[model samples]
Target: MLNHSAGIRPQTRQRVLDAITELGYRPNQAARALVTSRSQVIGVLVATRAAAYGVQKMVYEIEDAAGDAGYRVAIATCLSDDVSVRDAVDRLVAQAVEALVVVGPQAGVFNRLTAHPLAIPFVMVASDRHDDLSVSFDQVEGARIATRHLIELGHTRILHLAGPVGWVEADARMRGYLAELADHGLAPRPVIRCEWTADSGYRAACEVLGTTDVTAVFCSNDQTALGLLHALHESGRRVPQDVSVIGFDDVPDSAHYRPPLTTIRQDFAVAGQRAVGMLLAQLRAAPPPPADPVRPRLVVRDSTAPPG
Candidate 1:
């Protein structure tokens, strides 16, 4: 026993494997897989840049759910392209993944996807358009809330900064802003179109400055609002006191701004969990399934006040 200390312990599993191999027996593969009918792996395709916080939160929630269900997650990056998304799907399929959760798909994906038949079950995250197996935040209600807050503060000459015209989410928010204003018989204020960026917001803000009688602006997103804040400061316009600013998407750090931002909040994590649940039910062909549409709400803060 003392001399045996220099030797390695006998390898038992290898010996068993060797015996099985010699006997042409598929012990592990046959026994484990035959009973389970599952590969225990799930594929995830994140379809946006790595920097988006909302997308990151969704991924975390999906990961938590997969772990609890005894499933291993395999992640792939689509990085925003129809070709890349399809390619990512191919890659995941090659890994023997049983299902997929595709995140941050653009509204156009549904149209593109209709052309191809999916080999594995798929669940789309943050799709603005409604789908049988989807969960989305209430963009329209949130934007309406943002606009109403300004209107209540005596902002009659309010403007709307909209995101790209073609995207479904942007259009939804715009609709809310329009409806909120129309209810009060307020004439339509000029709307600025821009990308979802702080710099674009700054440019749009400058355009708003050229026109007189503007009392407030409802930005389509937090980043654009941040840029508007900078532009207003540089142009000697005070927020709330001169021109109130409201934004959508209550991202972290909005509260720490010089004049804390008031915006709408979307529960991305909840949406992600709900989307996966719906997808799973569909995958299993559950009978008499029920999937209630998820709705978006709003959060208000200190960004708007009565206009002088």
Candidate 2:
């Protein structure tokens, strides 16, 4: 019998551990759960069908962090409109997850989740509501930085290609863009609200062609910027020669864009780890440590320059 309370000889303990290792012995999770009244599992609900770079990277880090904390992760994915947030939570709760982590910018998630309250603690990722246990890269600040860069490059007539409505991140980024322009005493130009896709961006840019006298454009995301670039190219407007373009969430392929993208770099891994850490604290009945929103940096590239 291996007695943990009674001090066993070190040699004996080592031999027992070696034998367990050699036999590939594993602990009985069911028995442990019975004793502790916990499933030792964390549920992650992501509101995206096609995971983008930031979402994909953050999920990876969250899984690693949860593993380090001696818990398993169960993931549930739902579309923005196809599946309701309540349905996703019900699925996770059915699995007996000890805690929950919701990821993405769907603002309606808050009210929906509040309506169907769960006994388990839940944390949010990449949300504008900081009053709760949430982790996010400051979207507004990143937008401000991107917009300010274009401003400093001598482009006063700047246009913002905004993200879809009802997204917390989209609202924050738009707020940042407005604030930056106000600080510089630049008049707010037309804000083209579009979907977060290259196609939408291209279409939006086309609409701006004959209507606006914009010299620079800040897209909500890298994909949108890519489309904007395509539109400019097709319209015989040389990038940085005719107009400067900037984007947010420096995705992996941003660096390889025709002109390489000038965008904001988010530390998704760090944010992921933080969100997981908060979940772990709840599991242990420990107070969560104070965490600040992750700061984003500007990556200067060929896509932006002083306006001609």
Return the top candidate by lDDT.
Answer: 2
Summarize candidate 1's per-residue lDDT along 1-308 as a digit string, tens digits. Answer: 21235355468555755787798964353355457776767888877553456777888888887777766688888756679778887888877778888775356765555567787777776677566655666678888888888888788888888987666568888998999889988876767898888999999888768776888889998888899999999999898788888887778978877689988877877876776676567667864234444555556666678896
**Clash number by candidate, in order:** 1, 0
List, residue by residue over 161-216, the lDDT tens digit for candidate 2.
Answer: 99988888788899999999999999988788988899999999898876788889
Off by over 4 Å in 1: 1-37, 287-290
Name the best candidate (by TM-score).
Answer: 2
Off by over 4 Å in 2: 1-28, 80-83
- Can you give the lDDT of residue 12 in candidate 2? 85
**Candidate 1: global Cα-lDDT?**
0.76
In candidate 2, residue 137 scores what lDDT?
A: 75
TM-score to native of every candidate shown? 0.82, 0.89
- Shift in Å, residue 190, candidate 1: 2.7
